[model samples]
Target: MTNPAISICRVLLPALLLSACGANSVVISGSFPTPNIGKLPIDLAVVYDDNLLDFMYTEYSETGQEEYYIQSGQSHIQLFNAVLPAMFDNVTFVDNLEAAADSGADAIFVPNIEEFQLALPAKTRLDVYEVWIKYNMRLLTAEGAYLADWELTSYGKTPTETFLTTESAINDAAVVALRDLASTFALSFARVPEISDWLANR
Candidate 1:
């Protein structure tokens, strides 16, 4: 007689494989409130490279049980747009060095997304989803002189129970990370020694 265990495995294996092969994709959307900080009395020009504007990240779970895709580029732009104006006298977007020089702004701000990392509940054996973002930020004069260059990082996490689907949880975590980024930049921008000096001189 065929063993009952063999029969059960045959019935369940395809279902398990189908579930494992499914992919989770999240298209992120984020917003931020204008920070309650004193506005710097300088016009600012911001530059975003193509890569940062259309950033998409993909990874497979450590156990190979799931795959995740996060599209976060546009949300980052939104976050900066919302927060920067509150911190500066004016804000403008520029396409290149030539545009930045001509923008009539006091300084140029460039932010590049250096890396993105994710942790799934499955991989961590925890009931949460986590996201990490690393950014390279630069402040320059209209004449292309570097005022400040630094690395900024942000992190966010959500309890798995907060969302029913993996996609939603991941998206929420990413949004949190973006908010963190905005808060950190707004609060710390003028505190950077070089930036403080520039503000003082201006």
Candidate 2:
């Protein structure tokens, strides 16, 4: 005699897998607003390390179930590199505040990311992949004091929820996270005066 539950699981599993691999990826788009008036700086440097990633990864891990780890930090760095140019027109790097001050950077946009997530429904038929990023950056002066701390989150959705031979859902999740980071930061910067000043100077 065939077990009904077993039969149901067999049918649902494949269907879920199929649907899971083809979820729609959602993304937000935006840019920073022009400051009405302020002292804008130029030339700033970014210093990031394991401490920042550790904080972010911890938060990102909180949103999902099952044990997982970052296969590579390269993606996160690449994403930041991609978005930084667009965020600051005059951005530059220096060894420290002393160098930055000498270089005449009016301000800084120091950012620390807190979270990047890839999510899916638990025990579901489809692969429903989701990507998320949460981070905080401080805009500081050559004095080593902060002008403001900007907290940002970026999220993405996949086109579908299924995985054939390839893992489209996971890929979408990462891409979405990267794209949204730029968009989210752009919007947040536009809304914050200090950020505008910092970016203008950078």
Candidate 3:
């Protein structure tokens, strides 16, 4: 089916929509399939901060006729659950970074959402909905010593013609970003100097 050709101000659809000219509350259900990579021989602990678990991005157009919201916090956990286990022998989750020091883990990983941006076709004058996610990664030893810290970005876009509604296109774009994040993390983990050293010493 083809996307409906309608003005952003007239695209009032979906349960999370607002009565204003237009509003979109796109709920991104994650889809991070397990990677077909070998696991590292280490037990790991991951920390999910409250912000990451409840991440929501909201914005309004300058004209006050459009608003957008992306709910991705819950999906972030699902993304990690799917990828971390494939990258480590044993994976455990902790509420806080400090708690991991005593959790009998070899290392701790903390992923924080640095920024999330969305661009609708109306805003960018483009034919696609775009999503960009920036993440800050903190790596620590079991004893809470710093191993490494780095930033990574993931991007995704869905053609406007592909989805029948704005929220659907936005949702697909966000999913693509999450998938990119998972794949990039798994492939880049062993290449960081500090992390490689930690793995070597272990």
Clash totals, every prediction? 0, 34, 0
Clashes of 3: 0
Q: Write candidate 3's Cα lDDT for 1-202 as tens digits.
A: 5455644335545423645445668789856789999989989999998989989998678686448778899888899988999999999998887788879998899998999998889879999889999999998888888889999899999887842698788888999999999999999999988888878987
Error in Å for residue 188 of model 3: 0.5
lDDT of 1 at 62: 61
lDDT of 1 at 192: 89
Put down candidate 2 lDDT per residue, 66-178, tens digits, no spaces. 23433325455555555555555566655455666666665655566665665555433455666677777777776768788867787776656334212445555666666
Worst 10 residues of 3 by lDDT: 7-16
Error of 3 at 167 (Å): 0.6
Global CA lDDT computed for model 2 = 0.57
C-alpha TM-score for every candidate: 0.85, 0.60, 0.86
Better candidate number, 1 or 3, judged by TM-score: 3
lDDT of 1 by residue, 66-184 (tens): 47778898899888889989999899988887799998889999998999999988778998889999999999999889999989999999898843788888888999999899999
Q: Candidate 2: RMSD over Cα atoms?
A: 11.0
Estimate the TM-score for candidate 2. 0.60
* Global Cα lDDT for candidate 1: 0.88
Global lDDT of model 3 = 0.86
The prediction achieving the highest lDDT against the true structure is 1
